[model samples]
Target: MGKMKNGLTGGFSGKVGTLVGSSVKGQNILRNAPKKSSKNPTAGQLSHRQKFTLVSSFLRPLNGLIKRHFGSAQKLKSKVNLALAYHLKEAVNQVEDGFVVNLSKVVISKGILQTIFVDTVAIVNKELTLTWSANLVFGSVNKTDVLTVVIYQKATESMFILEQVAERGAGECKVQLPASFEDTGYGIWIFLTDVGLVECSTSVFLGEF
Candidate 1:
């Protein structure tokens, strides 16, 4: 209604009833708070939202694994969500050619496959045992590659990881499930990591054993 100096008294410089005005660096600035859009989202927006929902559904179950192996729960979740979204976006075109890919089978890193190919999952003495085919070419370059096994219990939201240096002839390993996780169902994910990226297998469920 009236121009007033903005001082400790909290006075305004211009009309304050409907639209407010303020001065910045001696320039008068007038604005109103923006309102949310009311229009329906475009088809592209809907598709993007669908993809995110699908990816998040797959990842939500892995929260325990992310927190346990990757650390910084919140940070890992955001990183995985973004990375998976990009991966799916790029793979959508490939799917048209019948090259359907499972998100769980995709690894975040690009690298030569080095880990043993898991053949079967078995239970031994209250533990999950994984058997694999050897990859002799894994470290022929003499680059250090690490083998990691991750067991995730979707039902109980529990996860465990076993890490070992990739050896030329090793073929089997076991992961002891925590006693607290007894009688809980689990999903197994194995990875082969070199100095660069990690390549992992799609999770396999071994019902409570």
Candidate 2:
């Protein structure tokens, strides 16, 4: 009975030893096993360096487009402002003359020469009259000035002398344009005196039907 008891105790001890060894081996294997990453990255997620590089790639072009649009808007605004200012100055100048020049109704009927023509539309059944004033600041002054109005077609360089008159000081001259000059666009050139002192010239268009 003593020997049987000792054998049973040894057997129990052997079983415990085997269990402890197996547990130790299992722990070591688990520690050495490959660990899984807790988080999975999507396409949007990248390294900080990569994110900065990607953003920088698109920034330059985006900035350029924004600047280009801004510049175009600024240019258009400038042109509009300039046009407004020019008309305002012209209005102020007309006030000095008591608004004698009603350019709003002026019309050029005939193509005189090279995109220039005479304002021939009859205002109040009277032939169109062109009134001009010149302030001679320098050079030789003449009391009797030879004023020549040259007309030209807007689309062509061909020009013709519409009217030439010798007048004293500032005066008004009426021109009777032939009926054939209607419908074509024209511009005017005013030559003051024979010395080629070019005065202010402007465009004239035929009135609408």
Candidate 3:
């Protein structure tokens, strides 16, 4: 059953046959209802579904980062959705069993802010150091910009986020790993934000270390 907003001359809301009429963002819209099928999914469809599972699960924990710094605002899609679309297309690759996110291709934050060329990723005495050189971009790079990092622990499936760990001009930032953190393999990312924290630079993957 459907209800017409302005009699039969105007748009409607509800279901009618195979079409669904609804209002979205103050606009009337009509779309076809999804049809149920008896056929089994194809191999390619299954493969894509597995990839989606892999990427979405990995990005779930970074909701705070993505929501705040992933990208500029858009009308219909949120920042997280934009990040998901980007990773699905650019960061996922097929693996032996199913799929896995290619960490090197991942981008946690995105903007016009200038980034840096990583010269080193080293950990000694439980202290992590990230060194970089200035990289050019559309916006003027500032030495006062703050560095942000996220370390993904594969064994525990957890993340350790460091906000404003150091300044970009410092060339390197040292982080003391958690006391209980064992030195297995871990994924790391680096990005920067202005002193005010109003904008961010695109993220760089430091590979698993």
Highest-lDDT candidate: 3
lDDT tens digits by residue: candidate 2, 40-118: 8664454433434433332222232222211222333432233333333342222442322122332212112222223
The model with the greatest TM-score is 3
lDDT of each: 0.52, 0.36, 0.85
TM-score of each candidate structure, all chains considered together: 0.47, 0.29, 0.77
**Which scores better on lDDT, 1 or 3?**
3
Q: Per-residue lDDT tens digits of candidate 1, residues 1-209? A: 74767564654566665666776545566676355699999977787776666555555645444423331224324445544655566534334523333534433332344445567778666676676666566434333445666565556555565555344256666667667665555556555554443333223333233
Kindly give the number of clashing pairs for every candidate.
0, 20, 0
**RMSD, one per candidate, in order:** 10.8, 35.0, 4.4
- Per-residue error at 100 for model 2, in Å? 35
